[model samples]
Target chain A: MLWACLRFPQLAFDALRGTLPNTPGAFAVVAGPAQRRGIVFANAAARGAGVRAGQAIATAQALCPHLCLLARDPAAEQQALGAFATLAWRYSSDIHLREPDAVLLEVGASLKLFDGWPALERRLRDEIARSGFACRIAAAPTACAAQVLTFAHDGIALTTTAVLQGALAQLPLAQGGLESATVTALHGMGLRTLGDLFRLPRAELARRTGPAALLHLDRLRGHLAEACPRWQPPARFARRLEFESAAHSTTALAFPLQRLLRELELFLLARDGGVQHFVLVLGHERGASTRVAVGLLAPQRDAAHLLELARVRLERIALPAPVYSLALQVDELPPLTPPHRDLFDTRAQGGLDWPALAERLRARLGDGALHGLACVADHRPTHAWRHTPLDPAAPATRDATAPAPTANRPFWLLPQPLVLRTAPQRILAGPERIESGWWDAHDQRRDYYVVELRGGQRAWAFTEAGSRQHWTLHGWFA
Target chain B: MFTSTADLFALDSLPASTAWPVAAPATTPASAPASVPAARNTAALDTVLRHPGIWRRRAPGTSALATQPSGHAALDALLPGGGWPRGALCELLVEHDGLGECSLLLPTLAALTQARRRVVLVAPPYVPYAPALAAAGVDLRHVVQIDAAHTDTHWTAEQCLRSGCCGAVLDWLPRSDYRELRRLQLAAESSGTLGFVFRPLAAADQASPCALRLRITTAMNGTQFELLKCRGRLGGATSLRLRA
Candidate 1:
């Protein structure tokens, strides 16, 4: 099987570049504790000024007076590697990530589908370049061999096993994936290349260099049946970004928050999914993370719409403290369903994008401000209906084919039935007795009638079960 | 070219394939074969217009104003468009806040709700009693009420109308000037949604940009629908009585 290896040699610096602001001067990634730190990666400008990896920070800065130093973050580097593996998974299902740097993908099954090696290689190079990473890519018969060859050349696609072995023989042992100690020991034994090492007796080499060296040689030559752990994408998505400076106000956070949302949009688009609920966590220096959970009436994946909803939600919140980092987590991702549009609309904008507008309004106005009315099966006026939250996913309980109310009903019912002293001028309809709602604690029995008052206003009035001949105004026809 | 008046009468005697009022192509009259077929097609079109089975042009005095049926035949006749004029303002001037105004608009609003069109109520004076509206065949799931600030009432109404997200917007703006009403009229026209502005009865004398103005008053027997102002028809002369 043919395997493709993508080696990102400077991931320590490249991973942090996306989160930081674009600066003019060069920067180098420093590793280890504060007291014993050294430069691990440098930009072109830093390298041109005589800065090299594994040198003390003080020595490197003395050599290049204008060099900037940034502390390396291992968590961000891991996340970036996972993102690269996810991108590579689009081309091949079988993928294994070599931590801190590279990805190995089995591309033998994908060659014909992607229109052969050259086209697939061009696409991979273009996409990786667009993602802001410098990669050294190589394809060989085995995963380990492909990775080892990637360090020797920028782009190499050797298909046959004979050509792969021939290319490996010429590559220097220093460039192969081996510990510095192993390479030094091999050089002490007068072995300069894989060709020199291959001619030695296997048992003698194993007795001298131990099992790790022999395993390495076996894996490189496709003789070892090693089990490489395949990478699986996590069901939930969580991304974090630490800002250069703390954002004290909502306006200041908008730019970085927008960038986080754009990344999430691309993530969901690649998965062919949509999120209905997500939480934005703002990490503050002194207090706990403040979480803003943004929900939608329907699942959405569009970045612009999600940003607009987040903007409205942000307007209503007061920042508890200055935030230095932001984490976006999406726990619920449902498959996206196509939006329903009116069939006969000829307008430039299709007939009423209602679901999107509803979500926007709900975000601006709290959930308490929006509700849907539902009818309950009760004879009493007040107990007959209830308000339900506006959720599009909830199945509708009110049947459209249900029978209508038999008695005459007014459009508006008074909140509290007012006691009346006098009778009306005329009675338009007869008394309708309603005696239900016995199961619930609040029960009522009354006779309702539609009448016109003396001052020429139509109203609905009811009299109690016991004889209090005085009429009570319950509602208006309006 | 049939410049002379007598030459027009000679078209009836010409061959059926020739067009009416033939042009005088004197120089190359015999060699023009293409014009013969083109003229014959015009003649065939004329024959189609004269056919008894076809309806040639609409009859005069038949109104063509687009309307949404008010669901009441007698009220539809009183309306200028034979129903409620859509995409225009309809002002309901009430003597009192509860003088059967909701009853008058319940039918139209219910139809819109059942059609899956959203009905928005902006700053309603009281909580919309759910049971009553549900009993009247109004789908409650499609109803949305906005309790906006007094300063934002007009702005909210205008936005809801302009958004095209609502099939009808019922705003209770008891006090508004000419400019505010005009903005709402334009918003309704642009979005093609019905905008109903409920105002006090005292505003009847003030001129409005609404297409239909109704003054509802309660009477001893029933309710009165007084057509105070209609866009293209005389007002105050036509009134209807309904048993509320």
Candidate 2:
């Protein structure tokens, strides 16, 4: 299999930097114990200021007094690797995540689908660059060899096993991805490159550096197939972004939220599905996180539309405390069936669809703000209709066969019946005796009448069965 | 030089079946046939009449404006195009709520919903009775009710109108100025969706950008309508007895 290995040489620095807004500054990532913390990665600005990796935190500060030293987070680095693997899944399904920094994809099958190796490579590079990662990619017949070549060369492509062997021979022992102890032992014996080690007697090499080193060499040469555990995408998508500083307002969180959303979009693309419900947890400095639940009427995956809905919801929320991080978790990604389009149907050609518009309204006005109307088979006016959630997938299953009511119903119903103080001028049409709802305990035994007030406004008034002197205005014909 | 209006009318010799010209005829050559200039003038007239914005009195029914019958014969007779104008905002200034305001447009809303087109009700003042709407032959499935706050009513209405997914958007704006109405009007025009804005009768004297505005007040038997503004013609106080 033709495997492509993507190595992020500065994953720790890039992962943390990506979470912050774009700004030019000397930054360095320091790791190890607090007492012996040293710079593990230094950005270009820091390197220019005479700061380099492996320097003590104190020394780096002395070199560049204004340097921004961030503690290296292994969790963030791991998350960045998973995100890259999700992106690579779009190119091929056979993905392998080499822990800490690299990912290998079996692109031999995908090359034809993407119209050959060069086009596929270009697309992969473009996606990597757009994701803001410094990646060194190399291809070989074996996964181990591809991973090793990434250390020796950035963009080397070895198609055949013979060419892969030749390339591996030129790679220095240090960059051959062997155990450091074995590399040191081999160096002590005057072996400068993998080619010198390969020429040694197999029994002698095994006796000197143990069998694990020999096995690694065999896997790299394709003599022994590497069984690296294939990476399987998690069932649910969850990504988090930590702010360099506490975000005092929702507006300050928009940029980082956008990045997480784009990553979620890529994740959805990899899964070939859409998300109907997701939650954004706004992490505060202490106590509980503010959770903003975003739900859609239908499955959606478009990043811009999702961001718009999220922004509207974000604007309405009052942050309890300054947000320090943001995490987006989307469970249950349903398969998306794109709306069918007819060539000649020009209605809402380029505008938002009905579901999307409804979602936006609901996002701003709260979930209960928008609803569909459904008529219930009840005699009581208040119980005659119910509010139903708008479900676009469901067909209009209106009960057309239901018998029409003999009496005319008013167009508008008041939430509560109002007691009328003045008497009506004349009676128009009702006084239909209605007695129902005994089963639900909301029994009503009233004679409803259509009456016209002094101003000629038609109103629906009702009186208790025994009392015609008192009338309650229940509805309006308008 | 063509001086009299009759002379300009006399030069209209192009066939009625001629297709609309794709582009305005370039500057006519000096030595062209004498009839060429007359044909160019006729072509220009055709272009003007074909514009969707323009209304022609002679062929009122033939104007390229979509309309839905208001279901009242007397009211339709008074309205331009013989019905409620589609793809344009229609304003109804009500003296109060229960003067057959909802009944006036119930027929058009029913027709839209029955035709499988969605009808959005944005921040309606009251809960529209479902049984009455169903009894009025409105498809309850296609009716969406959006209960937005007073501050967001105009924005919600504009979004619904501009989406083009809804066949009509009906909103009640008790406190809106002319600029807000104009924005809704433009959104409806662009998306070709029917928009209805209901306001208090106090704003009847204010200028509006709607295509039609009718002031309804309680009459002897039913509701009386005074046409304050209609896009194509000078509106008159045409009274019709709407059934209660």
Candidate 3:
């Protein structure tokens, strides 16, 4: 019934400081791109050099001369975080991403099951080490207490009342963790110890220090709730495959994963669906396995498309250890009915040979490679098409009326026209100018037509209302 | 007959970007032939050389269309008529020329634009080209057109059809297979638009997807266009053509 909050105290900055040398110099990690490589992902090294967090890159470099720069690999940290989460998940199901850089673990139920308080704390610390994170771990009976302890004692476990009291007594209230003026008031009152604040009557404290001051007292005493939102569990399309013998080779692991993947596909298929996003659990080595998750830009049903996308990501996945079992999970998927508008039309025209076709195309061409053109709701002929992920059932939109070109129009438009007739010109046919805009830019112009000699070919073209010089080839009579 | 190594050495200089300033204009190689060049098309299109898989399967497998047999043996035999012209465009008009009635053409249109072919419905009455075409295995990518003829939709479509891009072209105008139809038919013959006219559901007769004409309707699936006005040898329609 109770939730335990475990927290990491300034873990990112602390991790940076412990590693970086103490020099009055700024250093940054430069990993991803060629230019502006020095924008600090973790800037604690520069902080000591009077280069504050979020300071301009130029200023940071100017302030600190001998900065030990490592390319900032968010991908690397993200990857490390994933491995960390899997290890953390083994400790508890209630895991929240406080960002890829941090996590929140709810371990109230875990404490009782994992032996007594000290043992539980040791186990949590051991698991953090096991995950390859030189992490600072803090825990308390209350989420806020654990959170405060994590920040207060730099990851020391909070258990005994004296230890808890000691931790809370020294923790300062800042950034609403402790309100302003209250700290000043407390300073003026000469009350630095939370133990000093603890002695005041609860009602008197709320009245004298102002209502906000009560929050610090409440949080320190575990009266305030841990305000972090809980993670939502994904819908279960997950099925696990347990083997009698633990498999270690890639092919063997793939066999089990593929089987689970098929079931996941069929389950999603039965739901008339496909998964664009999913999580993976590898519990093959008897409760010890890696978990890799992926979020796709587009939802897909075809297994190959998902697999190739998986492969690009998985190639980077060096297995933490060998696999024994694998679990495939899919989330947030729309049901994929037989590629038909009406569900009942078993006799509907053309069986979904196209989806079969769609599957093949998705396989050979990377998922992102073959995209259907989504028409942009714009009057300009060139801006008419956009590459949208091919969703057969995507709602078809009716195009608004376009201005009838006064010039000869071509069989196909070359996306954008090198505006030949920029200026307004006289017309041969009726002057019909089309101007439309709601979600996009409107071209309000009286399109007039004129014929001009280009490369010795008489080209039909159109011009805007005011400009008369820009003329574009509309089409050939041929 | 050749190994990869042998083939490489036997060839002329390898294709490379480095020699572009000089090698760019050497006889404009397309005028001659290469051994099945994978790359063909305008240089500009090359900038957006849409990877091939989306265009079509490298080699189309068995045509997905299961075209039902038309009564006319000669025509049915000409087609794998059990299915429409798979992978090819079959244009149908709303007028009868030599085919007895528009009904006769249904099975064929049903066949060519059938489920296997992935039909593309060009121009039709505002009824948003029938979904029933799908039942026929017509993989019509979409029902799109510059319905507004203000621009050159016809010309644009002509280019598309001549490019052998779609499975068919269905123009609903009252024009019979006159000069342009002849031009289009000749154009279709090589480029692949299996042109047919759906003469005013009750127009005279013509020759098309089927050799015989029939009165086809939603209520009565398909009936023979018993009175034939054209299609010389098998001029008269005597039997009911099945609509798949």
Candidate 4:
């Protein structure tokens, strides 16, 4: 198996840069704000001024008077790592996150699909660059050796067992991620390079150190395989962002909501799916949560479209209280079907873009504002049809056995039949009787006829045949 | 050269400069032809034949404009360019709400809906009888109804038309101003949707910006259609009949 390891040496600094647009000066990411705070990461400019990692905050400030310090945000670092893992997953399914800064990918199975090692490496480099991360990539026969080489070199691919062993032999024994005491002992014993340590007898190394050192060496050299749990995408997308200050208005929430949506878009794109239903929960300071559910007629993954829909829905809502946190959850993710386009036709036709327009209208006008017409198989004119919510899954078509309309059905049917006081001047057509509806409530028995009024207007009027001889105007004919 | 007032004003003594019409650029070599004609017979016959407004001799009722048949031959013949004018408003004025107005437009709506294009009905007087629409061959899935109040009726209709997703939008406006109608017309023209507005017959006396306006009234045998305005024909001259 071949493994590629990508190490982010300046994860703390890069995380800040990825989140904010314009960050000035050479700042160090400190571990904490209290008594235990120390510089965990420093940029090149800060290093030039004598500030380095593992230095006390006071000592760093004394060395570089203008050094800006920022507290390390573990949440942001974890989010950034998740985003990178999603990017790696596009090329290979077997990927593991090496914490604080690296992603390990088992790419042996994906080499053929990406046209072998050279092309795959090139693609990985280009995609990482596009994602705005500075990574040092190295490949080896095992994940452990690849991770170690990524820290010291750039783009080193050791494919076969001989090449891996040769590359590992050239590395200094200090770079094997051993404790400082062990490295010092090795140095005192005059073992500098990994080759020197390997040349020693196995019994002698165990006598010098313990069996843990030997096991670590074996795992690094591919002699022993360790279980590297593969990262799986979460079944549903649920990301929460805590605001520094409570957001009092919807406009204030847009920025953070946009970041969450961008992440969701990347997540969906990696899985080749689209979201149909999602909910936005606003957490209030008083422990109450306001949830806004946004549903689309079609599955959509476009960030701008989803944001626009969210904005419209948010406008109509009255916030219960100031929100301290916001969470986005999506439960329904349907596979996206690419729209079919006619090769010969070049016009921007109305096949795919209409759903976006419908979604936009729905967002503004509110839910239940848009619906399609459906015909029920009832004999009563008022009970004949109903309004159905529009669905994108079902294409527009009529069932073959859908009841064929009679020739004389009126276009307009009154909700309640208007009682006719006077009789008609001329009888134009039928005394057709529609006497159904004994099964359900509101039974009706009447003799319906088409008669013309004195103004030469034809009307569909029905007369009760039971107790009362009352005439009612049911509808109008063309 | 003589230095005198006469030398400056004398036509014969002064050197002639190149005139504006015949002046040639120094960079452009004299080898190239001069004075290319501004006007040329660049109109191709194929494009002319494809133009929607132009009439062709091959067919009697065919024009270049794409048309959805009205499902009534008599009404189709009465309309200019053979069928309903696309991307323009067709105003149908009636005395009352339910005087066969919906029936007149149902055929066209069904045809558009059947073709998988959306047909939105905005602010109808009553619920659309779905059984009747389905029976008329309309794809029920594509027929959307927007419930808008009187204040938001025009705005909703304009938005639906401007979306370009709907093949047709039918709006029943109880009262509308001339400006609103013009805006609706412009939206329809820009989005390429077939627009139909049902207005009161009293508004028919006022001039409209619609492409086609017909006064529909109940006649002896059936519904009568009087063409009030057409794109390329004289208005109020033709009357067509449809069976009841």
Superposition error at A40 for model 2 (Å): 7.4
Estimate candidate 1's alpha-carbon lDDT, on a 0 to 1 scale. 0.79
What tens digits encode model 3's per-residue C-alpha lDDT throughout A66-94?
Answer: 75555444544544454455455555777
DockQ of 3: 0.02
Task: Classify candidate 1 by CAPRI docking class.
Answer: acceptable
Q: What 10-residue stretch in candidate 3 chain A is worst by lDDT?
A: A402-411
Off by over 4 Å in 4: A12-39, A42-71, A112-134, A201-204, A238-260, A280-292, A314-329, A344-352, A395-404, A424-439, A465-468, B1-66, B113-117, B220-222, B234-237, B241-244
Model 4 agreement with the true structure over A1-478: per-residue lDDT tens digits: 9999988888888887855547567788999658879999998889999998999998999999999888888888887888788888988899999897999999999998999888998988898788677889998899989998986789989999888888888899888766778889999988897778778899999899688888878888888987968898666899999888899999898988898899899889999899988999999977789999998888889898899899888887988899999999998779988655458742234432567767877887767788877777667777777777777777545655446665676667777789888888777777777788888876977788888776667788888754235678887764
| Model 4 C-alpha RMSD to native | 10.5
iRMS, model 2 (angstroms)? 1.4
Chain B, per-candidate TM-score = 0.73, 0.81, 0.42, 0.76
Native interface contacts retained, candidate 3: 0.00
**lDDT of candidate 1 at residue A34, scale 0 to 100:** 72
Candidate 4 has an lDDT of: 0.79
- Which segments of model 2 are wrong by more than 4 Å? A9-73, A129-134, A162-214, A221-224, A234-253, A273-291, A318-342, A345-352, A396-407, A422-424, A466-469, B1-34, B50-64, B95-97, B201-207, B234-237
- How many residue pairs clash in each candidate at the backbone level? 1, 0, 74, 0
